[model samples]
Target: MIADARRAVVRAGVAIGIGMGGFVDGILFHQILQIHNMLSARIPPDTLVGAKVNMVWDGVFHAFVWGVTALGVALLWRARGGSARVPGRMFGGALLLGWGSFNLIEGVIDHHLLALHHVVERLGPSVWDWVFLVSGVALAATGWMLTRQIDS
Candidate 1:
């Protein structure tokens, strides 16, 4: 019983970490850096006229991401019988890595080809975009590897 509780805690912590990491990324890039939000492209011209609309949408998006992540953690906890098993850890790690990869690739393609705002709009756009991509990949990989080690 105690072991089960401990495992549940660990899984929840891992989920929180991943979700918080994602939140930080969104806050830093979308808010502080003034980069494009998830749906920046869909906005009609001269609607909000500035970053206000983007900020609102970004907040909502981050909220949803956080919710989903928390739900994922709950599901994992239930599915694995509240144990930090090797498979659970690997699955969580892979999820983080996949999300990071998607962000990196999408950011690059959108900024470079689609003319969307860079990862950090204030930082000369393209350069910061690449930097963001690399950093995201690094973070995700590190999380994945560390989780794998924990599982092992």
Candidate 2:
């Protein structure tokens, strides 16, 4: 049986991982690399207005990620009071799982289903999108294995 504290720690790690993943996507892909935006598919970022619109949406996405990260921080703080020990491996696995989950869900919804954006807007639904999804599944599987090992 898993301890309540362990569960709490895992949850917190996952949440923080998700938030961190989002920040990486936003900062690296959206801002630094200048690849794609939240609504780059529908609103091309060629003009000033289009760029501003995408920026606003990006801000919204960041805000949501921040909230998730804050929630994780609170959970971690709360779990610290518990007597049960949380293995470091468990926390690390949880983070990987969370990041992978984010990639899978976001890639499917934004890049495929809704067509909100792609990994590379210039490519227009190329192999890079598939690679993203595959990498996410790989990360999630590895994380799951690590967590299961620690749990057992």
By lDDT, the best candidate is 2
> Every model's Cα RMSD, please?
5.8, 1.9
Question: Backbone clash tally for model 2?
Answer: 0
Q: Write the per-residue lDDT of candidate 1 for residues 57-151, one digit (tens) a residue.
A: 67776886688578757756675663455355555665665456546655667666674555644443557677767876885786568555444
Q: Evaluate model 2: give its TM-score.
A: 0.92
Model 2 misplaced stretches (Cα beyond 4 Å)? 82-85
* Shift of residue 68 alpha carbon in model 1, Å: 2.7
Q: Please give the lDDT score for candidate 1.
A: 0.60
For each candidate in the order shown, give its overall lDDT on alpha carbons: 0.60, 0.85
Residues 1-152, model 2: lDDT tens digits: 35776678778888888888888889999999999999998899999999999999999999999998898888878776754556778888888887888889889999999999999988889998998899789878877766666554
